[model samples]
Each structure stands twice: as C-alpha cells, then as structure tokens.
Target chain A: MEFNSRIPIYLQVIDTIKKQLVTGKIPPGNKLPSTRELAVEYNINPNTAARIYKEMELMDICYTKRGLGTFATQSEERVGEMKKDITMEVISQFVNQMEELGYTSDDMVKEIRKRSKR
Target chain B: MKYLQTENLTKKFGSTVAVDGVNVVLEKGKIYGLLGPNGSGKSTFMKMVAGLFHPTSGNMMVQGNKLSILSKGEIAFMPTEAYFYNYMKVRTVGEFHEDFYEDFDTAKYEELIKDMNLDMNMKVSALSSGMAAKLKLAATMARDAKLFMLDEPLNGIDLIARDQIMSAIIKKASEDNIMLLSSHLIDVLENILDEVIFIKEGKIVLSGDAEEIREEKGKSIVDLYKEVFAS
Candidate 1:
C-alpha cells in the first residue's frame, strides 16, 4: 500500500490491517504473519513492524500465543463494533468535507438517495 | 543494547576535515539511515566505523570493544565503488568472500544471486553497472555479521532493481544485528529506516527515531531532508 509520508507508518499499517480484519479479508481468529514476515510484506522497517503488532495487541484487535504467532481477535461482537466505528469515522470525514462544500444534511441524504437508485 | 557507539569520532584528510566529531549510538535490531548529500562525510563516517580509516580524534566501540581487527570480522562493509576482479565470474565472487570471511554464507549468496537474476557464468567485468550494484549488495548481505554497513546501495540502479535490493535488505534484517545504510535517496530509504541521522558538511545536524521525527516535525523524512539541505 502507498503510505502518506507525513503520518506515522505504523498507524497507517494498523488502519490497513483493521480494515482487512473488519472486512473479513483477514478472517477473524486467522493467523497473522510474523513480525519479520509483515515487515518484508509491507517493505517497512522491522522495528516498526514489531510496534504495529504491539499496538494491535493493546487495542485487542489481535492476540499472541507463545511460539505460535499472533492471531486476529475471534470475538464476533468486537469485530461488529469495530466495523461500525470505522463506518462512522469514514462518514464523519465525508460529512465534514461536504459541509465545507456547502452541502447540508438534507442535501447529502438526497444526493445519496439519487446516487443509490442509479 | 548498544552495538556501536562513537564519541567525537573525527577524520581528517590532511587539512580537510572529512568527518568532524560525529557522536552517535547505534543499537542492535535497528536499521539506521545515514543520510546526507554527496561529499557530506557519510562515506568517511562509515569507513571509520568499518575500520578502513583511522579516526583523527575520539574513538568508537563495537560491541564494547574498541575498533579492532576482530571487530572488522563482525562488520560487513560494502563500498560505493566496484571492488571486484575483472576475470572472476559472478559465482567466483561469492567463493572469494567465503574464503575471506568465515561468516560468509555460501548458500545465502547463491540464493541472493538467483533472486537478483544474475547468471553465475557471467563475467564480473561484463555485467552492467546496475548488475554490479546488485552483486555488491548480495555479496555484502550474504555475510552473517553483527554489523552491516552499506554505502549508497541504491546508487546507479533502476526502479525494479531498487525494489529487489530493498527486499534483500529487509530479508537480511534481524533482531541480532545492526544494519546501517547511507543514502541520499531519502524517500526510498525512509520507510525502512528505524532511525535517521542527517549529516551535513562533516557533522551530524539532526538525528532521531524516524517515526518520531515525522510526528514531531509534521513532515516526512524526505521533506525534512529538503529542508535541512536547502541552500
């Protein structure tokens, strides 16, 4: 994935993995690659890869088993909540941008209604 | 743990001070980008660490030992210029390193050679500059050393080959060794650098964790590079 240079790369990677997890692209409870493997896959620094796993673990998005490697969180309810959180986050961003463009809430609803019918 | 530490390390070419009192502490399991423009003392700093050039002042310690012959064995230095025999085949280069460094892994060399798409039968002199760069990187990275110092590893290489070289570097990185790569190509090296040291006119001007620098400066390392070197 192309990264925005201004932001911390680990944060971007975390979001990417979170999206993958919520979308079922990386299925729940599935094994995640080792830190070194992830570094190679993303072409990022190995230390940054370790930090990514550490942050994910703290957020409860993933957990590790000694010598068995890290796995995605298996709790379906947690995954559902994460999906809603991400959806709201994205919608807020869109709403803010539309607000700047002089689009009201009714206008946005009408626009979405118009586009979905097509 | 500190793998390499230098205190006021300086190098002088007669009256010209090439490296001026560079003090830095490098730890194991991290990849450091020694970033600077050409003639910014990056090479001089690396050579001193590699034990090729004696420091005019101060000293450096490698794994708690002063820079010595034994430390050279643990350090793998890939110079910018091509340093290969014209008559040697691509395979012979690996064998030559194997004979010189006890830590040289022949199997890893062969795998890197294949991954680099270099023919073993090809003559070293016959390969293009890009191929030679790849050859140099593969040879240096094949060494199972405690410290790996590469000078301008991405110089004179195409885009595709750059990706291959970066992949090779990422594969060689581990928690047991320190990899120091000097490059002016900040954008290409930025993502893979755990820390970045910016050297200018023979002195270190700025140094910090890569991500933390970006977070604090509100700009990428590339932008910071431009800001630092802008005249």
Candidate 2:
C-alpha cells in the first residue's frame, strides 16, 4: 500500500481493512492474513501488525478463534454499522476538503447534487 | 529489555573522533534504518556495535549483557568491504561462515544464493560489486543471529537485485530477531523500516517509528532525510 505521510499508519491500515470489509472483498467469516504475514506484506513491525488486529477486534469487525486464526465477524448488524461508519468518514473528509477550498455547506450540497445529476 | 543499548558510545582514532556520544536503544521485532551521510560516523558506530572496533568510551549492551564474546556471536555484521578470498568460489564463502558462526544455516545460504541467481562456481574476485553484496547479505542473513547489522547491503545493486535482496531480508525477519540496516537509499528502505534513526556528527538527531515520523513531519522519509542532512 502507498501510505499517506499525513495520517497515522495504523489508521491507514484500518481504513484499508474496513474498506475491504464494507465492499465484501473479504466476505464475512474470512480469516485475515496472519500477523506475521501482514507485517511482511506492509513491511512493518510485528508489534504494529498485532495492533491492527487488536484495533479490529475492539471495533468488533473481527474475532480471534483461538489457535485457528482471526476471522471477520459474521454478524450482518456489525457489517451494516461498519458501512455507515465508512460513509460518514468519506462525507466528513469531503466536507472538510470543500471547507478548505472556501466552499460553504450549501455550495457543497449544490455542487455534489449537480455532479451526481450528470 | 532492550535488544541493544549504547550509552555515550564513542570511538576515536588518535586525535580524530569517528563516533561521539551516540546513545540509542533498539528493540527486537523491529527493522531499523541507520541513516547518515558519508563520514557522519555511521560506520564507526556500527563497527563498535559489531565488536570490530573498541569504543573509546561509554558502554553498550546486547541482550542485557555488555559487549563481549557472547554478544559478538549473536550480532552479524556485514561490512562494506568485499572480504571474500580471491580464489574462493561463491559457495566457499558460505562454508566459511558455517564453520565460523554456530548459527549459520548452510541450507538457507544455498537457497539465498540460488534465489539471488548467483553462480556458485564463480570465483569471488570475478563477481560484480552487486553480486558481491548479495553474497555478503546472503551469508550474513543465513545466520540465525539475534541482531543483523548490514552495512550498505544495496550499495551498487541494480533495481531487480535490490528487490530480491529486500524480499530475502523481509523473509528472514521475525519477531525474535532485529535487523539494523544502513543505507543512503532512503526511499527504498523507508517502507520496510519499522523505525528510523538519523545520525549527524555521531549523535542521533532524530529517531522514531518510520510511519510516525512521516505523520509528525508531514513529509516522506526521503524528504525528511533531505531536510535533516541539508543545512
């Protein structure tokens, strides 16, 4: 992954996992890559890689199966919640970026609707 | 416990100071980058850690023990120089390491040599600089040491060979071992490093989690390296 220098790396990693979860790229009940494998893939510390799973567990997005491995939550309710969270995240970022460009809320809504209409 | 710790580590040659008052802590399970310009005391610091050169002052601890014979065995130092015998074939170097280091794995060395596409029958002196580096890295990494210090492993390696060497390093890395690599190739090494230590005049000017440093500075490692070395 091409990491952004702006955000914390773990956040970037979380976002990627959340993206996959919401999009069903990694469907429910799927096992995540082992912590060691994840570390190698991202070229990060194993401790940092473990943090990724810990955060995911705290968010109820995945659960550990003892010796088996960590698997994505099979609950549809949590998946729905994750989808809403992702949507809100994108919306806030868009709004904040528009605000940076000196565009007001009304201007943003108008432009967004105009663009969606076409 | 710190995997490696140096308190006021200093090294001098006669009246000239090569390393001075460098204090740094390293932990296992992390890949660290040792960054500095030439003559910034990077090599001197590494040599001190490797036990190749005695420190003029200060103390260093490896695995909770002071620098001693025990620590030396667990620390694999790949020096910048191509030290292989001129008549020794590439495979002969692996044999030499196997006999010298108790932890050296001849099988892994053979695997690495093949993966590196090195001709085992070729004489050491006939190999190119890049191949020689790969051989050095392969030999050093084949050992299951507690610490692996690679000094300029990718110095003159081409792009493709750099990738191969990097993958091998990543594969060899585990939660039980620490790899400290020195390189001027910040862009290539940054992504793989867990932490980055920037040295200037033998002191650590900046060091932190690689990604954390980027977030804190709002610049890539390459940019940070340039900004630190500049001026």
Candidate 3:
C-alpha cells in the first residue's frame, strides 16, 4: 500500500490490510503480513505498522495466537461485516454519481443488471 | 457567520508544541483543506478544532459559539482512525449515531447504507480498513451539524474510493455547513477547497482564498504546497 504523506501512516496500514481481507488475498485464519514486513513494504516506521496491527487485533479483524505470528480471525460472517462497513461510505458516492448522471433508481437497477450479465 | 474559528489556539504535547498561535477563520458554506507535512501539526490542529484535545491555550468557536462548551451533539469529528463499536452491526452504529448526535438523520444513513450495497447486519469488527474508513465517513457525514471536521478523510481507500469519499463530502456540504478536511492528498483537495490553510511547525504558514492563493502564488495549489512544505 502506498502511503500518502498527508494522512497518518497507521491509517494506510489499516486500509491495505482491509483490502487484503475483503479480496480474500488474506483469507480467514491466514497469517498476516508481519509488522516488520508491512513496515518494509510501505517504507513506513515499523512502530506505525505495529500500531495498525494492534488496532486491528482490538477490532477483532485479526488475532494473535501467541508464540506464533498474527493470523486473520476466523469468522464465517466477516464478508457481510466488511460489506456493510464499506457500503455506507460508498453509497453516498454512488448516489452523488447517479445524481450527476441524472440516473433514477430504475436506470441504476437496469445498469446494474446489464453489468452483471457480462 | 463564520462556521468554524479558532482563537489563538495552541496545543502542546509535553514540551513539544504541535500547534501554536493558530488564529484561523473558516467561513460558512466553504471547504477548507488543512494541509501540512507529517507532524507539522495538521491533525493536532484539527483535533483542537474538534475539541478532542482542549487547547492548552486559546479557544475554538463554531458558528460564533465556543466548541468547548457545546455538547458532542453539535460538532461531528471524524478522526483518521475509525471509531466504532466493533461488536455492533453496521445498522447498530446508525442507532448509536442517532442517539448521540441530535442532528443525525437516520433516514439518510440508511439510504446511504443501501446505496453502498452494504449489508446492515454485518459486524463492524469484521470490516477491512477501507471499510472502516468508509464507515467513519458515512457516520460523520450523516450528521447535520454546523461544523464537520474530518481528519484525513481520504487517508485510506483506493483511488476510486477516494473519488467516492470526495464526492460524498461535496454532496453533503452546504452553505449552512463548514467542512474542514485535512489530507496529505493535495491534488485531490486542490480543486475542492474554497480556501487553503497550510501549517508548518505548528503555525499557519499560509492561508487565503484558493483562487487568490493560486493567482498570487503563480502556480497550482499543489505546486505551491510542494514549495511551502518542501522537505
């Protein structure tokens, strides 16, 4: 994940891991990118990455097995959780775009159906 | 009336001054981008305005009223870190917002939830970082406060998501409202902000109308930022 100099770096770490989890790039029970590895990958302060992981662990997005590296928390219901969390922010954007394009609910549904076909 | 104003605001951590002598005025119905380098005091400055950290010296007033005295119901602060009950479902967060913020619009929140294609039943703890950031944005934007202070609103999320976040903020902002957004993404904010305020070493380095700053600086706001915040 590329870190923007403006936003706090810990946030970038959180965003990156979130994407990995949602895309199944890091499935449940999967060992996460080590704090050191994440720090190196983003070229950020290691302390910052550790802080992000610690926050995620608190959020129950990941768990530490002790003596072993941190692993993705096993939750069959997580995909729904993530979708709801992301959709709230994304929906407003979608509504704004539809407003810009002058698309009504019917038009939006049709567009979605059309997109789904292919 | 000025939507948000800070009077001689000063914030210090231990002996370190994160913000010093900051007297800023953000007018109603305008978006102000608080720009600065890392640890240059952008977040601290925002925190002070949000009343997260009491100004060690000085004061912040929203709509000419001191924010310190006003209840949390009046001002909505979206910190860079997502603040939600991880154990709660997404729908429950909406209830929490409604309960805390007097101006929170539950209908708007629910509509946004559906529009975003999110499952209201999902637990917050199961969300990814991007999801958390987005959720934070939604929760904050759902409020009908006089002032909205967003610290690094687009700090996370993909380029597409960044555009979405920006669009949401723009759509939600109004003449009766003030949106103070701090982000390192100068390019994204350059066109959106009606005014620009730059901070360096805990002081207001430069601030003025965005267009005037562009005209006076003789460069895009991004270029000016690069020059001002040059490492």
lDDT of all predictions, in order shown? 0.93, 0.87, 0.77
* Rank by TM-score (best first): 1, 2, 3
Model 1, residue B93: distance off in Å is: 0.6
Q: Which 10 consecutive positions of candidate 2 chain A have the poorest summed lDDT?
A: A39-48
Q: Please provide, for model 1 over A75-106, each residue's C-alpha lDDT reduced to its tens digit, 9 standing for 90 to 100.
A: 98888988999999999999999999999999
Q: Pick the candidate with the highest TM-score.
A: 1
Cα displacement (Å) at residue B159, model 3: 1.7
Q: What is the DockQ of the complex in model 1?
A: 0.81
lDDT of 2 by residue, B60-137 (tens): 988667888988899999999988899899889988999999999988889989989997788898998889889999
Error of 3 at B22 (Å): 0.2
Off-target runs (Cα >4 Å) in candidate 2 are A91-118, B114-128, B208-222
Highest DockQ: give the candidate number: 1
Write out fnat for all predictions, comma-separated: 0.89, 0.50, 0.00
The docking category that best describes candidate 3 is incorrect
lDDT of 3 by residue, B1-231 (tens): 566667889988899999999999977767788998788898888777666787899977766666755644667788887778878989999999899877899888877666455668879999877777777888888888877889898786777666567767766766677888887788777656778899999999899977677666667778889898886
Root-mean-square deviation of every model = 1.5, 3.4, 20.5
Model 1 global lDDT (CA atoms, 0 to 1) = 0.93
TM-score of each: 0.96, 0.84, 0.64
Give the poorly placed runs of model 1, Cα more than 4 Å off. Answer: A114-118
